[model samples]
Target: MKKDIILAGVGGQGILSIAAIIGQAALNQNLHIKQAEVHGMSQRGGDVQSNLRICSEPIHSDLISLGRADAIISLEPMEALRYIPYLSPEGWIVVNSVPYINIPNYPEIERLDAEFAKMPHVISFDVDAIAREHGGVRTVNMVLLGAASLILDIEDTKLEEAIGDIFGRKGDKVVEMNVNAFRAGREAGKKQMKG
Candidate 1:
Protein backbone atom coordinates (compact mmCIF):
# COMPACT_ATOMS: atom_id res chain seq x y z
CA MET A 1 0.00 0.00 0.00
CA LYS A 2 1.00 3.61 -0.55
CA LYS A 3 -0.15 6.92 0.82
CA ASP A 4 0.76 10.44 -0.16
CA ILE A 5 0.17 13.04 2.52
CA ILE A 6 0.67 16.74 2.73
CA LEU A 7 1.19 18.19 6.17
CA ALA A 8 0.69 21.96 6.30
CA GLY A 9 0.51 24.80 8.78
CA VAL A 10 2.15 28.09 9.61
CA GLY A 11 5.66 28.05 11.00
CA GLY A 12 5.90 27.01 14.65
CA GLN A 13 2.57 25.25 14.59
CA GLY A 14 4.34 21.88 15.01
CA ILE A 15 3.52 20.52 11.57
CA LEU A 16 7.03 19.10 11.38
CA SER A 17 6.49 17.23 14.59
CA ILE A 18 3.45 15.61 13.01
CA ALA A 19 5.52 14.63 9.99
CA ALA A 20 8.19 13.14 12.18
CA ILE A 21 5.73 10.98 14.02
CA ILE A 22 4.17 9.77 10.80
CA GLY A 23 7.56 9.03 9.33
CA GLN A 24 8.62 7.12 12.39
CA ALA A 25 5.46 5.08 12.30
CA ALA A 26 5.94 4.23 8.65
CA LEU A 27 9.53 3.24 9.27
CA ASN A 28 8.44 1.03 12.12
CA GLN A 29 6.17 -0.76 9.68
CA ASN A 30 9.07 -1.33 7.28
CA LEU A 31 7.60 1.00 4.69
CA HIS A 32 9.65 3.18 2.39
CA ILE A 33 9.13 6.82 3.31
CA LYS A 34 10.17 9.99 1.51
CA GLN A 35 9.53 13.49 2.78
CA ALA A 36 10.09 16.95 1.35
CA GLU A 37 9.65 20.00 3.54
CA VAL A 38 9.22 23.64 2.58
CA HIS A 39 9.93 25.95 5.47
CA GLY A 40 9.10 29.31 3.97
CA MET A 41 9.54 31.99 6.65
CA SER A 42 8.62 29.46 9.28
CA GLN A 43 10.18 31.43 12.08
CA ARG A 44 7.97 34.35 11.14
CA GLY A 45 4.77 32.30 11.09
CA GLY A 46 5.04 31.82 7.36
CA ASP A 47 3.78 28.85 5.42
CA VAL A 48 5.34 25.46 6.26
CA GLN A 49 4.55 22.29 4.42
CA SER A 50 5.83 18.72 4.16
CA ASN A 51 5.11 16.12 1.55
CA LEU A 52 5.26 12.60 2.97
CA ARG A 53 5.06 9.49 0.82
CA ILE A 54 4.92 6.03 2.38
CA CYS A 55 4.79 2.88 0.35
CA SER A 56 5.57 -0.79 0.43
CA GLU A 57 7.74 -0.24 -2.62
CA PRO A 58 10.63 2.12 -3.02
CA ILE A 59 9.69 5.79 -3.52
CA HIS A 60 11.63 7.56 -6.27
CA SER A 61 10.39 11.04 -5.54
CA ASP A 62 10.06 13.11 -2.42
CA LEU A 63 7.40 15.45 -3.75
CA ILE A 64 3.69 14.80 -4.14
CA SER A 65 2.43 16.06 -7.49
CA LEU A 66 -0.84 17.88 -8.10
CA GLY A 67 -3.95 15.81 -7.43
CA ARG A 68 -1.88 12.87 -6.18
CA ALA A 69 -2.15 13.28 -2.43
CA ASP A 70 -4.17 10.69 -0.57
CA ALA A 71 -4.74 13.09 2.27
CA ILE A 72 -3.96 16.59 3.47
CA ILE A 73 -3.49 16.94 7.20
CA SER A 74 -3.23 20.57 8.20
CA LEU A 75 -2.82 22.32 11.49
CA GLU A 76 -4.47 25.45 10.14
CA PRO A 77 -7.68 25.79 8.12
CA MET A 78 -6.37 28.24 5.55
CA GLU A 79 -3.21 26.26 5.11
CA ALA A 80 -5.36 23.25 4.26
CA LEU A 81 -7.16 25.18 1.51
CA ARG A 82 -3.86 26.38 0.12
CA TYR A 83 -3.03 22.84 -0.98
CA ILE A 84 -6.27 21.99 -2.71
CA PRO A 85 -4.51 21.39 -6.00
CA TYR A 86 -2.59 18.53 -4.43
CA LEU A 87 -5.64 16.68 -3.26
CA SER A 88 -7.00 13.79 -5.28
CA PRO A 89 -10.71 13.68 -6.00
CA GLU A 90 -11.31 11.09 -3.32
CA GLY A 91 -8.68 12.39 -0.92
CA TRP A 92 -9.52 13.32 2.64
CA ILE A 93 -8.76 16.58 4.39
CA VAL A 94 -8.13 16.48 8.11
CA VAL A 95 -7.78 20.04 9.31
CA ASN A 96 -8.28 22.21 12.31
CA SER A 97 -11.62 23.98 12.22
CA VAL A 98 -10.09 27.10 13.78
CA PRO A 99 -8.37 29.75 11.69
CA TYR A 100 -4.98 31.22 12.46
CA ILE A 101 -5.36 34.85 11.44
CA ASN A 102 -1.91 36.39 11.46
CA ILE A 103 -2.35 38.51 8.37
CA PRO A 104 -4.62 41.53 8.07
CA ASN A 105 -5.91 40.37 4.71
CA TYR A 106 -6.88 36.88 5.74
CA PRO A 107 -9.96 35.69 3.93
CA GLU A 108 -13.32 35.92 5.65
CA ILE A 109 -14.45 32.90 7.70
CA GLU A 110 -17.66 32.49 5.73
CA ARG A 111 -15.81 32.21 2.44
CA LEU A 112 -13.42 29.64 3.88
CA ASP A 113 -16.23 27.67 5.49
CA ALA A 114 -18.25 27.71 2.27
CA GLU A 115 -15.32 26.34 0.33
CA PHE A 116 -14.69 23.58 2.88
CA ALA A 117 -18.37 22.69 2.87
CA LYS A 118 -18.02 21.84 -0.78
CA MET A 119 -15.46 19.15 -0.08
CA PRO A 120 -16.99 15.69 0.02
CA HIS A 121 -14.44 14.34 2.48
CA VAL A 122 -13.36 16.74 5.18
CA ILE A 123 -12.67 16.16 8.86
CA SER A 124 -12.37 19.42 10.73
CA PHE A 125 -12.70 20.33 14.37
CA ASP A 126 -11.43 22.76 17.00
CA VAL A 127 -8.14 20.89 17.45
CA ASP A 128 -6.41 23.72 19.27
CA ALA A 129 -9.23 23.96 21.73
CA ILE A 130 -9.15 20.22 22.21
CA ALA A 131 -5.44 20.32 22.86
CA ARG A 132 -5.84 23.17 25.34
CA GLU A 133 -8.38 21.14 27.22
CA HIS A 134 -6.23 18.02 27.13
CA GLY A 135 -2.75 19.26 27.98
CA GLY A 136 -2.52 22.90 27.03
CA VAL A 137 -1.43 24.29 23.63
CA ARG A 138 1.56 21.99 23.37
CA THR A 139 -0.68 19.10 22.46
CA VAL A 140 -2.35 20.61 19.40
CA ASN A 141 -0.10 18.78 16.98
CA MET A 142 -0.88 15.51 18.67
CA VAL A 143 -4.55 16.30 18.33
CA LEU A 144 -4.11 16.73 14.61
CA LEU A 145 -2.20 13.46 14.39
CA GLY A 146 -5.02 11.76 16.23
CA ALA A 147 -7.59 13.11 13.83
CA ALA A 148 -5.56 11.90 10.87
CA SER A 149 -5.19 8.47 12.45
CA LEU A 150 -8.37 7.22 10.85
CA ILE A 151 -6.90 7.72 7.42
CA LEU A 152 -3.44 6.45 8.26
CA ASP A 153 -2.42 2.97 7.18
CA ILE A 154 -0.58 2.34 10.41
CA GLU A 155 -2.31 0.74 13.35
CA ASP A 156 -3.46 2.88 16.28
CA THR A 157 -1.09 1.06 18.61
CA LYS A 158 1.77 1.86 16.27
CA LEU A 159 0.87 5.53 16.32
CA GLU A 160 0.63 5.46 20.10
CA GLU A 161 4.05 3.84 20.17
CA ALA A 162 5.43 6.48 17.86
CA ILE A 163 4.13 9.22 20.13
CA GLY A 164 5.74 7.56 23.09
CA ASP A 165 9.02 7.15 21.24
CA ILE A 166 8.97 10.72 20.01
CA PHE A 167 8.19 12.26 23.39
CA GLY A 168 9.67 9.60 25.63
CA ARG A 169 12.84 11.49 26.36
CA LYS A 170 10.80 14.38 27.65
CA GLY A 171 9.47 12.19 30.47
CA ASP A 172 6.50 10.00 31.11
CA LYS A 173 4.20 12.90 31.82
CA VAL A 174 4.79 14.42 28.41
CA VAL A 175 4.32 11.11 26.68
CA GLU A 176 1.07 10.46 28.53
CA MET A 177 -0.16 13.94 27.70
CA ASN A 178 0.44 13.49 23.98
CA VAL A 179 -1.16 10.05 24.06
CA ASN A 180 -4.27 11.56 25.57
CA ALA A 181 -4.28 14.30 22.98
CA PHE A 182 -4.04 11.73 20.20
CA ARG A 183 -6.86 9.61 21.54
CA ALA A 184 -9.09 12.62 22.07
CA GLY A 185 -8.41 13.77 18.53
CA ARG A 186 -9.11 10.28 17.24
CA GLU A 187 -12.47 10.26 19.00
CA ALA A 188 -13.30 13.62 17.48
CA GLY A 189 -12.35 12.34 14.04
CA LYS A 190 -14.53 9.30 14.54
CA LYS A 191 -17.43 11.54 15.44
CA GLN A 192 -16.87 13.56 12.31
CA MET A 193 -16.87 10.36 10.29
CA LYS A 194 -20.17 9.29 11.82
CA GLY A 195 -21.90 12.64 11.47
Candidate 2:
Protein backbone atom coordinates (compact mmCIF):
# COMPACT_ATOMS: atom_id res chain seq x y z
CA MET A 1 0.00 0.00 0.00
CA LYS A 2 1.12 3.52 -0.75
CA LYS A 3 -0.19 7.01 -0.10
CA ASP A 4 1.21 10.34 -1.16
CA ILE A 5 -0.59 13.05 0.75
CA ILE A 6 -0.33 16.79 0.63
CA LEU A 7 -1.29 18.42 3.90
CA ALA A 8 -2.11 22.11 3.66
CA GLY A 9 -3.30 24.76 6.09
CA VAL A 10 -2.44 28.09 7.62
CA GLY A 11 -0.01 28.35 10.49
CA GLY A 12 -1.05 27.36 14.01
CA GLN A 13 -3.80 25.13 12.66
CA GLY A 14 -1.99 22.00 13.83
CA ILE A 15 -0.72 20.93 10.42
CA LEU A 16 2.49 19.63 11.96
CA SER A 17 0.53 17.76 14.58
CA ILE A 18 -1.38 16.05 11.82
CA ALA A 19 1.89 15.11 10.16
CA ALA A 20 3.24 13.76 13.44
CA ILE A 21 0.22 11.57 14.05
CA ILE A 22 0.37 10.15 10.54
CA GLY A 23 4.08 9.56 10.81
CA GLN A 24 3.64 7.72 14.07
CA ALA A 25 0.89 5.59 12.64
CA ALA A 26 2.98 4.67 9.63
CA LEU A 27 5.87 3.72 11.88
CA ASN A 28 3.63 1.51 13.94
CA GLN A 29 2.64 -0.29 10.77
CA ASN A 30 6.28 -0.66 9.78
CA LEU A 31 5.83 1.41 6.68
CA HIS A 32 8.40 3.64 5.01
CA ILE A 33 7.63 7.33 5.25
CA LYS A 34 9.10 10.49 3.75
CA GLN A 35 8.04 14.03 4.54
CA ALA A 36 8.82 17.52 3.24
CA GLU A 37 7.43 20.61 4.91
CA VAL A 38 7.29 24.29 3.99
CA HIS A 39 6.43 26.68 6.79
CA GLY A 40 5.76 29.78 4.79
CA MET A 41 5.44 32.68 7.24
CA SER A 42 3.64 30.36 9.60
CA GLN A 43 4.13 32.67 12.55
CA ARG A 44 1.78 35.14 10.91
CA GLY A 45 -0.90 32.67 9.82
CA GLY A 46 0.74 32.15 6.44
CA ASP A 47 0.42 28.97 4.43
CA VAL A 48 2.03 25.81 5.86
CA GLN A 49 2.20 22.72 3.71
CA SER A 50 3.66 19.25 4.09
CA ASN A 51 4.30 16.48 1.63
CA LEU A 52 3.84 13.10 3.32
CA ARG A 53 4.65 9.89 1.50
CA ILE A 54 4.05 6.44 2.96
CA CYS A 55 4.51 3.02 1.46
CA SER A 56 5.57 -0.53 2.16
CA GLU A 57 8.83 -0.09 0.25
CA PRO A 58 11.65 2.38 0.47
CA ILE A 59 10.99 5.98 -0.58
CA HIS A 60 13.80 7.98 -2.18
CA SER A 61 12.23 11.41 -2.43
CA ASP A 62 10.46 13.50 0.18
CA LEU A 63 8.69 15.64 -2.36
CA ILE A 64 5.66 14.55 -4.33
CA SER A 65 5.72 15.42 -8.02
CA LEU A 66 2.88 17.29 -9.68
CA GLY A 67 -0.36 15.31 -10.14
CA ARG A 68 1.02 12.44 -8.12
CA ALA A 69 -0.51 13.01 -4.70
CA ASP A 70 -3.00 10.35 -3.67
CA ALA A 71 -4.73 12.78 -1.36
CA ILE A 72 -4.70 16.41 -0.31
CA ILE A 73 -5.74 16.78 3.29
CA SER A 74 -6.20 20.41 4.17
CA LEU A 75 -7.30 22.30 7.24
CA GLU A 76 -8.34 25.30 5.19
CA PRO A 77 -10.49 25.53 2.05
CA MET A 78 -8.33 27.94 0.14
CA GLU A 79 -5.21 26.10 1.09
CA ALA A 80 -6.81 22.93 -0.22
CA LEU A 81 -7.28 24.59 -3.61
CA ARG A 82 -3.72 25.86 -3.64
CA TYR A 83 -2.33 22.34 -3.99
CA ILE A 84 -4.71 21.01 -6.60
CA PRO A 85 -2.00 20.70 -9.21
CA TYR A 86 -0.25 18.19 -7.04
CA LEU A 87 -3.25 15.92 -6.72
CA SER A 88 -3.48 12.76 -8.81
CA PRO A 89 -6.36 12.07 -11.13
CA GLU A 90 -8.00 9.82 -8.57
CA GLY A 91 -6.71 11.73 -5.59
CA TRP A 92 -9.09 12.54 -2.78
CA ILE A 93 -9.36 15.99 -1.29
CA VAL A 94 -10.50 15.91 2.29
CA VAL A 95 -10.67 19.46 3.54
CA ASN A 96 -12.34 21.72 6.05
CA SER A 97 -14.98 24.05 4.70
CA VAL A 98 -14.10 26.81 7.16
CA PRO A 99 -11.73 29.53 6.02
CA TYR A 100 -8.96 31.02 8.07
CA ILE A 101 -8.96 34.42 6.41
CA ASN A 102 -5.51 35.79 7.14
CA ILE A 103 -5.09 37.67 3.91
CA PRO A 104 -6.45 41.05 2.81
CA ASN A 105 -8.45 39.57 -0.04
CA TYR A 106 -9.45 35.96 0.50
CA PRO A 107 -11.74 34.43 -2.06
CA GLU A 108 -15.46 34.25 -1.34
CA ILE A 109 -16.78 31.03 0.16
CA GLU A 110 -19.20 30.65 -2.74
CA ARG A 111 -16.40 30.87 -5.26
CA LEU A 112 -14.37 28.31 -3.37
CA ASP A 113 -17.39 26.04 -3.15
CA ALA A 114 -17.88 26.27 -6.89
CA GLU A 115 -14.26 25.36 -7.50
CA PHE A 116 -14.43 22.37 -5.22
CA ALA A 117 -17.67 21.31 -6.87
CA LYS A 118 -15.76 20.91 -10.12
CA MET A 119 -13.45 18.36 -8.58
CA PRO A 120 -14.21 14.68 -8.98
CA HIS A 121 -13.18 13.44 -5.54
CA VAL A 122 -13.64 16.00 -2.83
CA ILE A 123 -14.81 15.60 0.74
CA SER A 124 -15.34 19.06 2.14
CA PHE A 125 -17.10 19.93 5.38
CA ASP A 126 -17.11 22.31 8.31
CA VAL A 127 -14.47 20.43 10.28
CA ASP A 128 -14.17 23.32 12.72
CA ALA A 129 -17.84 23.01 13.58
CA ILE A 130 -17.46 19.27 13.89
CA ALA A 131 -14.48 19.75 16.17
CA ARG A 132 -16.50 22.15 18.31
CA GLU A 133 -19.24 19.57 18.58
CA HIS A 134 -16.85 16.76 19.45
CA GLY A 135 -13.98 18.24 21.45
CA GLY A 136 -13.79 22.01 20.89
CA VAL A 137 -12.12 24.14 18.21
CA ARG A 138 -8.66 23.05 19.25
CA THR A 139 -9.33 19.59 17.86
CA VAL A 140 -9.90 20.92 14.37
CA ASN A 141 -6.71 19.35 13.02
CA MET A 142 -7.55 15.96 14.47
CA VAL A 143 -11.00 16.28 12.95
CA LEU A 144 -9.59 16.94 9.52
CA LEU A 145 -7.13 14.10 9.99
CA GLY A 146 -10.01 11.81 10.83
CA ALA A 147 -11.73 12.68 7.58
CA ALA A 148 -8.55 12.07 5.65
CA SER A 149 -8.04 8.79 7.47
CA LEU A 150 -10.72 7.13 5.38
CA ILE A 151 -8.57 7.50 2.31
CA LEU A 152 -5.25 6.79 3.95
CA ASP A 153 -3.60 3.39 3.72
CA ILE A 154 -3.30 3.20 7.50
CA GLU A 155 -5.93 1.55 9.63
CA ASP A 156 -8.27 3.57 11.82
CA THR A 157 -7.17 1.74 14.96
CA LYS A 158 -3.56 2.53 14.13
CA LEU A 159 -4.35 6.20 13.79
CA GLU A 160 -6.26 6.14 17.07
CA GLU A 161 -3.35 4.38 18.72
CA ALA A 162 -0.98 7.03 17.41
CA ILE A 163 -3.28 9.71 18.76
CA GLY A 164 -3.22 8.03 22.13
CA ASP A 165 0.53 7.82 22.13
CA ILE A 166 1.03 11.38 20.97
CA PHE A 167 -1.39 12.97 23.41
CA GLY A 168 -0.73 10.59 26.28
CA ARG A 169 1.78 12.94 27.84
CA LYS A 170 -0.90 15.58 28.03
CA GLY A 171 -3.24 13.17 29.90
CA ASP A 172 -5.97 10.67 29.15
CA LYS A 173 -8.62 13.33 28.81
CA VAL A 174 -6.78 15.11 26.02
CA VAL A 175 -6.21 11.85 24.22
CA GLU A 176 -9.84 10.86 24.51
CA MET A 177 -11.00 14.23 23.27
CA ASN A 178 -8.77 13.98 20.19
CA VAL A 179 -9.79 10.39 19.55
CA ASN A 180 -13.44 11.38 19.76
CA ALA A 181 -12.85 14.24 17.40
CA PHE A 182 -11.12 11.88 14.99
CA ARG A 183 -13.96 9.40 15.12
CA ALA A 184 -16.51 12.11 14.54
CA GLY A 185 -14.58 13.32 11.51
CA ARG A 186 -14.37 9.77 10.18
CA GLU A 187 -18.13 9.34 10.47
CA ALA A 188 -18.67 12.66 8.73
CA GLY A 189 -16.27 11.61 6.02
CA LYS A 190 -18.15 8.36 5.56
CA LYS A 191 -21.37 10.27 5.05
CA GLN A 192 -19.71 12.53 2.55
CA MET A 193 -18.35 9.57 0.66
CA LYS A 194 -21.74 7.94 0.55
CA GLY A 195 -23.65 11.00 -0.65
Q: What TM-score would every model get versus the actual structure?
A: 0.96, 0.96
Clashing pairs in 2: none
lDDT of 2 by residue, 1-195 (tens): 889999998878878899999999999989999988875456467888999999999999989999999999998999999999999988999999889987889989999999888889988888988988987888998988898889896889999999998999999999999999999999998888622
**Residue 84 lDDT (model 1):** 99
Model 2 alpha-carbon drift over 4 Å, by segment: 40-42
**TM-score winner:** 1
lDDT of 1 by residue, 1-195 (tens): 999999999887878899999999988889999999875456578988999999999999889999999999998899999999999989999999899999999999899989889998999989988899899899999998998999887898999999988899999999999999999999999888622
lDDT agreement with native, every candidate: 0.91, 0.90
Q: Which stretches of candidate 1 lie over 4 Å from their true place?
A: 40-42
RMSD (Å) of each candidate, 1 decimal: 1.3, 1.4
